[model samples]
Target: MTALLSRPGRVAAAFSPAHIGRAATLALHDELALAPKPGLVSFEDTGSHDDMDAHTFMRSLLALRSYFTHMAELGAAFAPFDALERSGIEAEARMLAATGGINTHRGAIFMLGLLCAAAGATQADGLALSADHWRAALQQHWGAALQARCARASVLSGGRAARQYGLRSASEEAALGLPVLFECAVPAWRAAQARGLSGQRLQLQVFFQIMAELDDCNIAHRGGLEGLAFARTEAQRFLMNGGATRTEALTDAREIHAAFVARRLSPGGCADTLSAVCLLHRLGALG
Candidate 1:
């Protein structure tokens, strides 16, 4: 008998890209504009400020990080999925997964996001997507041109990746009090580089506290913002344990992050708990 650890995948050749026309892109934009997540609480009609306007309970942190990273790595990843050579690209994405370099769970999530984006370019079907059929999300696009691209991808890859990781539907961002996006690169990356920044403990601590607040909101309600909060708080604790220098700013910042961590909004198991503690040792959030 084969061990479960060495079992074969139920699905094969999970995701691949298909040629989509110009209209597909437009349809994708429409989907972004119209897609909604069920069980969303306290929504803001406007798409402004990711901080307070989105729903996030069913959200997967690993998925969102890939979403951000895929946007970051589009140049490297897009080649395979390009319309001209999608078959080759799809093969490559699969190969990358086989090599264990690509994150299997996240890779699927990335495809779902792209496929969903493509689906938005069409009005092919009027079928509202449930969690299961989101890979076939084109039905909900009202039969737009983007649905054609989605259909193509579905036909080629059988929508395995889309179906596998199409767990959360995108919705309007929540802006509890913060802005839509947190460009950590500003003070955290670029600014530090320019300043030849060495001392970051305090700043890192403050950022952690901010994240804690965000996570608190997520626990109170359900939204995508929790991931960022989780990442931030973890980063803070790791910094604290590192024995960072005590400066006026640094001390104050550390206090804030520490305070947030001290307040437990939800119960976390080893993974979440350890991660929260792990981050304080780092100099700042990213580094």
Candidate 2:
């Protein structure tokens, strides 16, 4: 348990009331129209999931995926008595869906993160994985996890989940950074709080530092820009039970080749993705 608790993103202590209050406050905001904050996550309207060429689109997705898993593990660790944690987790899921798609392994990582964060796993309590490290792990291990989750969601939620996962394409991952992700992530977590006092922002305060530590989780597995194509081919070939073979991993190298072709739209995609990332970087649940 100590080792598990010590995961890079894990919190060393329990969250404070004030922190929780802040989380609740922001999470419940009425979708205020604020200027496009820039940081952390980066997306653009130009390319579809299929259009994400290496570098930014692919790398960001890779990072987001890992963060999701670290965060999910953190949430599952916290066995709570009320809905505050659970509700927040659900809200995180919504945010990920709107911001990050769950089609590819990286997107799945974000899903995992949202659920875990919602469960109330503060950096103080445990779940210690950096965003980068976590992303590396997910990029490395998420294939198996995605297959498993895809199958599970398919069976439980019906084919709707499976088809949606299929929509993830090769792009649409998040970029969780140290300075941006950790420095600003807590406020988003604080907003996630379901029920709490006014101005205390306990959830926000606690989440502020906690989400930042998640940076380790983000870059741990690093398959490189080339890995995205491989992952995509593997996804196409083997999924759930069929599974991706080593040869198929190579076969998918075409995705990278294709990435170069589509990169013309990077600038726009980068900007939009950044907009969402910035919001997430500063935004929290508190809902």
Candidate 3:
């Protein structure tokens, strides 16, 4: 049986490796459950990519479950940054093998994997598992390493696109302590919650907010600067027109989804940020 830990006004769960794994899995599930997400796969439909669907994402999730737990364990042990990077590399290969070479959760694997490690690190130090705490720990422990790694050439499509378009790569985001998540996405989520939004509506609100502001390289890779501009403009319009608060919000989102599919554009970076937001929510770090 899983153990639990308690604190004043908040219950702190025991830092079992499995607990960390479950958090990652739950975050992925939350992301998948959110529907009408433009150019992203969910239970209702396959977004822009014909190569992957909800089921394909499930397979990738299963393949990486152990990786999250193991990485957390490594972090609890205070493993070096290179060690964590190697662990993610192996997990990425496993995900590719499981999904027949389609890259579904590579971005999630990197961002969420680091998050799991940060969680473990925080727990190891008996610190409260809040978003601010984890973000600070992640920077303290791996910021330099991430910056150095970002300086090297990357062979991944997203990294290549980021360089070609002069956008921020995932590694750069990590080095900067995930500015989109900490600065934009999380704040949007909190504001939505304050306004009494919950469930899928709340999730969509956060997703759109991130999409509007993020320099999503996936969009750049698929549609270049013009495509990225178009995507940001659409997202900004959605937020300005009442976002998920209006009765017609879901309908508008579906239209956006259709438009993204038609363009073969995917705001995958935003999707990753959404997943991170979900993770933080699950961990009660958003509070």
Candidate 4:
């Protein structure tokens, strides 16, 4: 069992809707606070985005505060995916209203929300809060439904682009148990922490690692296949050269940020994945 839930009394409190929801919100906040992010928003400045910024993301986070809590509540009741889907739809509406129709956390509402639900369900089942257990809970409870949803067509631009480019959509990633998060991003985070890195350096290491790997439908939508390839290559080169450990790592990252912004490219999917890693770390799922 994880330390958070090792005690009997602590389990209920740990699994509370408010606590779980707060963790989800804080994870997004952590992601937003990371600077020198390639083609992403931060408290310092907006990168490659005129439609949204730190303020817009804050509004969306505030609006979503209750939605994640509600999802956990539903999961504790073992509610079906249809119920969760309805809740997500409602939450998305609230987010749009808060951000004036800007889609800042749309992907997060799907990815992190599901993780929160699974965390609730896992705790309710008296299981460990490890990544393995949470993942199992998600698959056991919602895998079939998610797979069915994945097979359907998406009218969204990102989804359309994924289809056009023969890349895996976010829906497909979720249905397959979020391999990028579980298989790639989490490991990168663990490796960074193991190297005794802290704060923004650790975050930068993981973010660049994700950017190098994630197929990022957002990149495809904005920059197309060529753009996606360029982004992957740049991110990979950053890691190969020295990543965040180098003395001039921040400068190099800022340069990459400038390049991405110049091309109007934003790796939103990678950003969402980074937020997922934050959530997992907060939940004690990242040893």
Minimum summed lDDT over a 10-residue window in model 3 is located at 1-10
How well does candidate 2 score on lDDT at residue 169?
15
* lDDT of model 1, residue 104: 21
lDDT of 4 by residue, 42-137 (tens): 998899999999999999999999999998888877889999999999999999999999999999999988988888888877776788888889
State TM-scores per candidate: 0.25, 0.27, 0.95, 0.95
Ordered list by TM-score, greatest first: 4, 3, 2, 1
Clashes of each: 44, 86, 0, 0
lDDT of 1 by residue, 14-125 (tens): 1211222122222222222221111111132312122222223112232233232232123213222343124324434543444344322222233333433323221122
What is the per-residue lDDT of model 2 for residues 175-219, given as tens digits with 9 covering 90 to 100? 122233333443433343433422323321222223222222221
Worst 10 residues of 1 by lDDT: 171-180
Cα lDDT tens digits for candidate 3, 1-287: 25556466554545577888888888988898899999889999999988899999999998999999998888878889989999999999999999999998999989999999988887776677888888988998888898898889989888899999999988899999999999999999999999999998999999999999888989999999999999999999999999999999999999999999999999999988898999888877888
For residue 73, model 4's alpha carbon misses the true position, in angstroms, by 1.2
Q: Model 4, clash count?
A: 0
Q: Candidates' lDDT values, in order?
A: 0.28, 0.31, 0.89, 0.90
Error of 2 at 46 (Å): 21
Best by lDDT: 4
Off by over 4 Å in 1: 1-184, 202-246, 265-287
Error of 2 at 161 (Å): 10
For candidate 3, what is the lDDT? 0.89
